[model samples]
Target: MAEEWRRETGGRRTSAARERFERIYHTLRDRICLLDYPPDTRLSEEALAEEFGISRTPLRRVLGLLEAQGLLKSVQGVGTIVTDVDLDELAQVYQLRMELAELLGKLSPVMPDEETLALFRAHHKRSLGLIDKPDPRTFARLNMDFLQALLLITGNEPLRDISERLYFQTTRIWLKLTAHMDIAEEVAVFSREIGDILAAVEIGDLEAAGYIRRSHISMSFTRLKKLTI
Candidate 1:
C-alpha cells in the first residue's frame, strides 16, 4: 500500500510541476511579445529563476522552449538574449502567416462543426469589443485569440502548429512597430475583415474567403511597411 501511494503521489507531483513550467513559459513569452523584455536584452538565468520563483532546472526547460520558438538565443559564454527584431525577419514571418492563412482558407471547404463555428464567431465579437481599449497588451491578446479561433477551423495539425509559432513571432514585431501608434481604427478594420471572412466560410465560399485572407495579410504588410519607414 505504501508503494502504491508513493507512485500516485509522484504522479501528482509531476503533473503539478508540468503545470507550473507551462505557466512560467507563457508568462515569459508574453513578456517577450509585449517587449517587456525587449530585443537583445540579456536574460540572466538566475535572475529569471528568482523572479519566477523557480529553480534553474525548470527555468532552463522554459528557456529551451522559447529558444526553439525563435524568441531567444543562448550564447555559449554570454548567456541567453532576446532575439534581434529584424525587419527582414518580420517580413518573412508575415509571409509565413499569409501562406498558412491561405492554406487554411483552402481547407475551409471541410466545414468545421457548429461548436467550432460558434467559438470563432464569439472570438470575433470579443475582438470587436476591445477595439476602443487603449491597452495594447489587451488588444494584442484579443487579436491572437481571434486568429487562433480561425485557425482551428482548418483542422490540420501541422498547419495549426506553424500558425501558432508564426502568430507569436508576428505579434512581437507588431507590438514593437505599433507601440507608439493609436491602433484602434486598425483593430476595428481587422475585426470587420474577420467578420467578412467568417461570413464567406459560412456560405461555403472558400474562394472568396481565400481572397479576403490574402488581401488582409497583404494590407497588413503594406501598413507595417509604412509604419516602419
Candidate 2:
C-alpha cells in the first residue's frame, strides 16, 4: 500500500510538472506572438528562471521546445533570441498553412460540442466589438483563441499538432507589421471570417469551415505581401 501510494504521488507530481511546463511554454509563445519580445531580443535564462521561481534546468526544457518551434534561436555568444519575421521567406509556410487548413475537416473531423460552438459564437461576438476600435494585440489574442477552438473539430493528432505549430510560426508576421497595415480593416476582415466559420460549423459543415479558413489565410497572405511591397 505504501509503494502504491508513492507511485500515485509520483504520477501526480509528474502531471503537475507537465502542466507548469506547458503554461510556461504558452506564456512565452504568446509574448513572442504579441511582439513583446521582438526580433533579436535575447532571453535571459537566469532572469526567466528567477521570475518563474524555478531552476534553469526545467526552464531550459521549455525554451528548448520554443526553439524547436522556430520562435527562438540559440546563438554562439548570445542567449536564445526571438527570430525575426519575413513575409517573403515565410511565403511557403503560408502556402502550406492554406493547404493544411483544408485538411482540418477532411481528416477525422470531430463535430464540436455545443459548448465549443457557443464558445465560437462568443469569439465571433467579441471579434465584432473590435472592428470599430481595433486593438492589434487584443485582436491577435482573439484570433489565437479562435484557432484553438477551431482545432477541436479535428480528431487527427498529427494534423492538429502540425496545424498549431504552423499557425504559431506565422502568427507574429501580421502583428509585426500592424504598424504599417490598417488594423481596423484587418479586424473587420477577421470578424467576418469568424462569423463565416461559425455559420459553417452551425450547419455541421466543417469542410466548408475549413475552406473558409483556407480562403482567409490566402487572402491575408496576399494582403501582407502587398503591404510589404
Q: Quick one: best lDDT, which candidate?
A: 2
Clashes of each: 0, 0
- Strongest candidate by TM-score: 2
Q: For each candidate in the order shown, give its overall lDDT on alpha carbons.
A: 0.75, 0.87
Q: In model 2, which runs have C-alpha deviations exceeding 4 angstroms?
A: 1-13
Question: How much is 137 displaced in model 1, in angstroms?
Answer: 2.0
**Across residues 1-229, which tens digit of lDDT does each residue of candidate 1 receive?**
1222233234455657767776887788888987889999989999888998888987887787788788899888898999966677888888877777778766534575788678768867876787767467777777767776676556566676677777787787677767656588778878888788779867867667767877898888888788888
Candidate 1 TM-score to native: 0.78
Pairs of residues at least 3 apart in sequence or in different chains that clash in candidate 2? none
Ten contiguous residues minimizing lDDT sum, candidate 2: 1-10
The per-residue C-alpha lDDT of model 2 at residue 14 equals: 69
Kindly list the per-residue Cα lDDT of model 2 for residues 1-229, writing each as its tens digit: 1222233234455667767777788899999998999999999999999999999997987787788778899999887999987556689999999999999999998998899999999999999999878998999999999999989888887788788888899999888788899999999999999999999999999999999999999999899888788
